[model samples]
Target chain A: MQGDERGAVMKPLRRPRALPGTATPRPRHRADRRPRSTLRTILALAAGGVVATGVALLASGGTYALWSDTADLAPATITAGSSTLTVAGVAEHAVEELDLTLLAPGRSVTTPRPVAVANTGTTPLAVTVSTIAIPDGNAQLAEFLRFETAVDTGGGETCDLAPFAVAALTGESASQPPVTILPGEEAQLCLRIGLTADAPASVQATSAVFSMIVTGDQVRVP
Target chain B: MIKRMSGTLALVLVLVLSGAGIGHAYWSAHGELTGRVAVGTLSMTQTGVDGLAAAFTTDVTEVTAPVVVTNDGTVSAPFALSFTGAPAAAEGTGQSSGDLGAATLVSVWPAADAASCASVPAGDAPDGSTSSTGWNAIPPLLGTLEPGGSAVHCVRAVIDPARAAPGDTVVVTSSLTSGIGSWSSTSTADFGQSFSDDAIVSPHSF
Candidate 1:
């Protein structure tokens, strides 16, 4: 015991001194390692969202206009022209205006009279002649009545086209072809109407009326 | 930051591929359209030379005249030659010999384009099929006549007087049937026998 006490009393007490620029070990706390706010994390997430939205918008914008085109179609229009005809004159004179209205069986009335056919319209017309009314149902009565046309022969009233042609309203006009009249054109022709000697008694006191039908067509633009 | 950028790039790619699956499709922007018709007209005209003023007789001589039929309408017409008002005739000499029914006629056309007829010999009847009951058979000579087209023909008859009787009284009418319409020339043949024999030359003027 006396030796231990003497050894402890003889031990030297020496302390080490800290030199300059020496680094000292520090305590690392969990809280000290972390950033102060969540601003950095929020910025990172927002950047990722921006990239996603950009890609979506670019893809969709291009797809919509790929197969589209436009053009201007031509327009169409339609119109109509006038068509008309008139047969009012007799032998170079207007019959209705002349007021000469008695017809005799033996003599041909209006023999020297020239009938004028006028076509007044912008377009041409096909004119047709017909008897709207005739003397009774006895068609034979019409056969005795002669309707004749004359050309401008020096002698006058003579038909050179065909000799002795007779038009007794034998429904011949009903079978007649249409006559063409040019726009603003007119025709003056000789007409002769008479009851032949063979006319029957039934034909007496008979009357007739004539009418003209007109037709026209449209011309297309070239 | 780099890791975040890379994660964002991957997320964008997934979104793009899934766009169609999420009801995405191409969008497009949109138009409709309709001509004219009218009825046509037809017309015809006819004329004769020297106006039929003379009576036909058995003179052993032929009478000739230029006759023209015109298609004045806008449409083409196929025409038929025909006769109207039956005429009486007798082939024997004396009063009965002047029968116009026995007489034959020739229609010779001028300007080939106007119309056509059989090449009948002079003083001979025209070489064509006769239809005393109805319309005569028209040769292809007269084709479909267009507007402004004309049919020209010379109607002639050769008869010998004295031997050919003088009692024939007939009024022969030459007619053209085009479609439902008809045109006629007024010409009469009188054997100097009777006024009834005279061809009542009637011109159906339009």
Candidate 2:
């Protein structure tokens, strides 16, 4: 009786028959089991790969932390150097009025006033006469005016008209080499101003007010 | 391909930024100065005119006009004088066929004052002398006058009996012009010579 009860409880592995007029049927158990097993294997592999990558990243982080070292440093103070240029001992960007009075036609007059360029900063500088600006309604007069310049590097030399043999127009750059000045050093600049003989009658009794800008660039020296 | 392209673009951006960071760096400063220049004026004026409006007679007569020239401008300038006019005869009068303007001789000379101008001898040419028929050439520099200075000049007109008729009348006009005579240097040293050491000290503050 026990053996019969066991036989009834266990079902037999057998293939089901197809309905009438149907094609040959596939094995449903085998096909469904194969697809489920393949999906579970792929999920298991993906989960294992993720866990292994996390372990590797943690190990790398732990290694870096174990090898790292730090040291304390003292505080440092830094101060920047300065570059400053002055004309006639005047401050930068300040308009220093120079006296060049009684300019006549057909004659050249050297200003009794001298232009002294001084480097009053902590660094050396290269100086250049950058620009000249003429006032309104004086363009005609500027055409006839000529200028010459010379530099005296504190050599106890007299600034005279001999150095002014070559002249240029007011709009043109002065034909002189760039002057290099050290800190606390000064250079004397002489200017000879002339009006051409062909200056017209209209320029008579007319006054021209103009400005000159000088630039200084810091130079590195060994 | 997209990953490779993105890596290449990142590299190019890094190179550009690095290049911009390597530009030159320096400190710069500037100064400015102003200059005022005044030009001297060259001009003159005719303050007064005398002796030019007189009538001439036939008998070798002389008339004198004292003209005054003033230097009105700021600069010293030299002056010159010129004359221009023509003689005309009255209409329907018996006077004709005579050139009184051509025959009339005019002379000019500088004098200390108007009163002294009359004392200048006739036919004396101090500055210049010309005929009244036409304009005279610009004469040599008569004299130089300083600013606001004046000088009296005598203009004498002489008429000859042989060249004038009874009804002939001539009017003369004189013009004065001033101009720059020459250029001179105020420097005592010879040109091209080294100048004396004259130092121009700059003020400490503006």
Candidate 3:
């Protein structure tokens, strides 16, 4: 190319080559001068990620519970029937109450005031009365006694204090009454206890023994 | 460059370890039910008395309440007896400790009168009384009560006097088993006179 004082005469300059693994340098842009904002954003994101992770861990810590497999147990014990038995098992209805109590002495009490038996059974039971067995020595009161069963649909049932063989307290005294119970349910029974006149002063007694035949099938135990 | 890479790797390692620790803690608390023990099953018996001879009678002179416990789950759950509504004058001791296969009875009633009865509590009771001779310290094992079966233990109740007069009756309350957070209803045993027995009383002369 011929060079003149004012005439066009220009040559291109060569750029340097990059070394191994080095990226070729380019012209600096406005973004390169202000990279602090992007670095700050990355650090903030890391911190937020850690905070979120900690919160998630806290929310799920040791949390557990059960849903099904709940079981209900029902026990039935018959005292003054043809057969004295107890039945206990798991059932569907929720058991409300099972209670037992003794009747006190009173003269006006007719037929050994009907023992107040409560029925907490989930389902109503057709309660019947039958003589189980007579006390070991009282073969005399056997003739004047008869038994009957009355169902109290709302709460419980009671045993008949009649003069039939199945009666619970036909010839019994008022002091201690007979026990009336709800089969397959929990209720109280009142028995007429005849404290013998020829008893010891301080007998440390345990439980009473009554030998009666069981006729109805209401006793259960699981 | 090396410093930047090392920092990132350390942070990742810490995060992974933290995650694992949280997972472990969670697993430890909410693990599955791993055990069950058959506590016991009770049988009922009624006997007849021939005579009414005493004022204060003891019905349960001997008792044998039995129970069975089994390990049904993968983990072990300890067992215990929780008593509710114990009578002040009641006398009786219960087995305090047991294992998967064995159980022992503890005595309670007829302890030198009502004062001695205080020494025996109904459920776990208090810890001040004399320790039972056998199976006293083992608080039911921490084991699974087999899913289907049970670990059995027997408890006995004995009555001192054979029979009581017409005016007296005895009330005994008890329960033989319990679960970790649930409760079984209290079982009751009663002894008293019936209608026919009342005839034994001498009639009032008119």
Judging by DockQ, tell me the better candidate of 1 and 3.
1
Candidate that would win on TM-score: 2
Candidate 2 — which residues are off by over 4 angstroms?
A1-80, A92-110, A135-148, A154-162, A165-176, A192-208, A220-222, B1-23, B39-42, B58-60, B76-78, B89-97, B121-144, B162-169, B178-206
Per-residue alpha-carbon lDDT of model 1 for B27-97, expressed as tens digits?
11100000001112345555663333234443223445555777765445566544433334443542433
lDDT of 3 by residue, B115-139 (tens): 3333343443233322232233323
Give the worst 10-residue stretch by lDDT in candidate 1 chain B: B29-38
* Best first by DockQ, ranked: 2, 1, 3
Predicted candidate 2 versus true structure: per-residue lDDT over A1-222, tens digit per residue: 698887877869666687789988755776456576567666655655555455544544434455678898899889888999898888533323332344556766665545788998889888877666666558988887766666678653445643653434454564566688898898876666677777777777777776666778899766
Winner on DockQ (1 vs 2): 2
Q: Write down the TM-score of every candidate.
A: 0.29, 0.56, 0.17
- CA-only RMSD, every prediction: 26.3, 17.3, 32.1
Q: For model 1, how does the per-residue alpha-carbon lDDT over A103-197 read when each residue is reduced to its tens digit?
A: 33344544334445565656655444443224244465455555554323232332323222343353345333444556676644445555565
Instruction: Flag the better candidate by DockQ, 2 or 3.
Output: 2
Q: Residue B186 deviation, candidate 1, in Å?
A: 15
True contacts recovered per prediction: 0.08, 0.58, 0.00
How does residue A219 of candidate 3 score in lDDT? 31
How many residue pairs clash in all the candidates, one count each? 45, 1, 111
Q: For candidate 3, write residues A28-110 as lDDT tens digits.
A: 89766757866766776676567556654554463235655666779878663232222112111111211012111110112
